[model samples]
Target: MSADRETLEVYNARAGDYAQTMGRDPAAMASLRAFVARLPKGGRVLDLGCGPGSWARAMLEMGFEVEATDASDAMVAEASKVEGLAVRKAVFEDIDDVARFDGIWANFSLLHAPRAAMPDHLARLYRALKPGGVLHVGLKEGTGERRDRLGRFYTYYTVAELTGLLADLDMVTDDLREGADKGLDGEVAGWFTLTARKIVPDTEARTDTA
Candidate 1:
């Protein structure tokens, strides 16, 4: 089976347990909060591939207007059930908004996309963001594609690999960190986390995604 289909099938089959067991590290949350704090007050945010809407809920509580989506219908259903959150089902390449978001969060989601599809998705994500928009992403560390014990397909990247990929999309790096920690499945894995900004030409000295 294709990695995309395999991963989605796995997520659809395990959405309930996945949501139930999802974990939030205080430090990670703090880091996210600090990153989004840079946006304009009550900025609009898109939680890309938001599973179960945890970060969507957090962003809502923090005063941002949050829109969310995931490729998995089951995951989207779970996210939409949360109070004040209405996530839709959508795939990575389908994001077509132009300068529409102040921030985009792809926490542990984009890793499921195959390596070949990454640049295209990244380009779409870049174009979807408003100038100066913040982009946050999380992925595990490894060389390439593989399946976890749960049968979910994942594409890993080194910190340098991630940097090169984002720069190829013309994104400006704000922060990148690598660490080993327990994932939601209660298994320890090396992780890559990054916060980057879109800059527009001749505007506050920032780069443009449009």
Candidate 2:
């Protein structure tokens, strides 16, 4: 079955429990910190599908202006409880702001979007970023989709597939890696992480396009 509103609602109902178990994976933390280090000082960052605001909190603590959004109301509420955080309750498809963010951290979130929906989602992310903005995406690397016992849908990606998608939008990848990490289940999980920068036109091209 396709993941719909009800599926998300179910996930939200368990948000607290999920937070307790997978609050912040250590590997995820390291990846995010590295992504932040490459960004300009005090840059505006958006945490797409930010669950419980862990990464958002980290970025805010680092002095970046961080804004977050999640499709689950329960997750949003939980994220808001974190001090000094702006958490929006909205789906990725609802995001419409353009050229406003310097960086976007979509850690382990876009996997919920089906393969067909990813291109449009990526386009929206590209539009939301300023010229030369960066985007960091994390996903489980595999062949198909599945839902774990917790009922959240996940889609995996191969490095080549992901790179091709980003390239189609003219984004230059700064980093990409695959590795194993502990999963919400008790087993090790394989995943891929990618960081890419929005390619901007040079002065001559910008002037002409303008």
Candidate 3:
């Protein structure tokens, strides 16, 4: 397993490259648009692991109040440079806010988290969202962990595994789709995209079919 310190170092080293690559992806922008369309108008959004603030910028353009955060200081600096974004440097494990967000966009960020930490991360995400708040996660579709040439660690998940994990948290998944496309590294990868909604107080008693 890659240590958190090493992971952060790898990302910090490549932060500028990652930001540049993300800026040129039209598909990523489209996906961000689709994710935001599911949210209510003028709601608060937390872009977890927001790199370079692109997604946060898009959300701001769509009339949502957004807070962008990442673990790497370099990334936070880049994100803060974007106009109209509130950027912070934070690790996912350090987030302890409760019921403050109307939506959480975690695009391709959780994949860096160790599998053992996924449950707790999901719980934190649950706690961060308001009742009926939306959570959109984009993950690579597979299992186990691997390191790319750049030495960044990545964890992949199967749909059933991811769905089961979320279901255990009382969050009902509203949609799941396969999103295979060429990524920044010029390699085709399969993506599992899910949109889950927090169960409201009155609806908590109902069973989730997702």
Instruction: Note the Cα lDDT for every prediction shown.
Output: 0.81, 0.83, 0.83
lDDT of 3 by residue, 1-210 (tens): 123676678767877888877756565666677778877899999999997887888789889999988988778888999898998888888779999999999988898888999999999999999988999988999888986565667899999999999999888885677778776556788887888888888656564433
How well does candidate 1 score on lDDT at residue 162? 81
TM-score, one value per model: 0.90, 0.90, 0.89
The residue-by-residue lDDT of candidate 1 on 1-210, one tens digit each, is 123887888778888988876645665686687778878999999998888888888888889999999888788888988788867788887789999999998888888888888888888889988888989988899897888877778888888888888898788886776678876456798887888788765754533322
Clashing pairs in 1: 199-206, 199-207, 199-208, 200-206, 200-207, 200-208
Task: Please identify model 2 stretches exceeding 4 Å from their true place.
Answer: 1-3, 204-210
- The alpha-carbon root-mean-square deviation between model 1 and the true structure, to one decimal in Å, is 3.4
Cα deviation at 132, candidate 1, in Å, is 0.7
